[model samples]
Target: MKARIHITLKNGVLDPQGKAVAHALESLGYAGINDVRQGKYIEIDLAKNDADTTRETVERMCRDLLANTVIENFTVEVG
Candidate 1:
């Protein structure tokens, strides 16, 4: 089982890095920009095919080490 985890800041959290990028884009003549947020995508390869168990394990992994639950959220997908 291959797992893809996307970690991102929750809504209402300030993203300074994303803001900087957006600003740079605007300076480069880009228009109509609404919003931006920085995030991470992690891909994991597993040896199993069960999504339920993988989801649980991935959630635990995120909570324990990969992502900080207080300021971020994660979505786990299998491939």
Candidate 2:
């Protein structure tokens, strides 16, 4: 089984890097550029045989080592 995980900053979190990128784009004369935010992604392969079990394990991984729940959120997809 294969799993894909996305970890991103929670709403209302300050994104200084994103703000800098936006300013740089404006300096380059880009039009209508609004804003940007940065996030994280993780992919894993599981030897477990069931989707339910795989999701459970990966969720645990996200909580333990993959994402910082203090200011971030994570989602998991299994295939």
Tens-digit lDDT track of model 2 for 1-79: 9999999889999988888988998999997977788788888999988999999999999999999999999999999
Candidate 2: list runs displaced more than 4 Å. none
After the best TM-score superposition of candidate 1, give how far the Cα of residue 60 lies from its true spot, in angstroms: 0.8
Q: How many angstroms is residue 3 displaced in model 1 relative to the true structure, after the best TM-score fit?
A: 0.9
Query: What TM-score, over all chains together, does every model reach?
Result: 0.91, 0.90
Which lDDT values do the candidates have, in the order given?
0.91, 0.92
CA lDDT, candidate 1, residue 69: 84
Candidate 1: stretches off by over 4 Å: none
Which residue pairs in candidate 2 collide? none
- The per-prediction tally of clashing pairs is 0, 0
> Model 2, 58: alpha-carbon shift in Å?
0.4
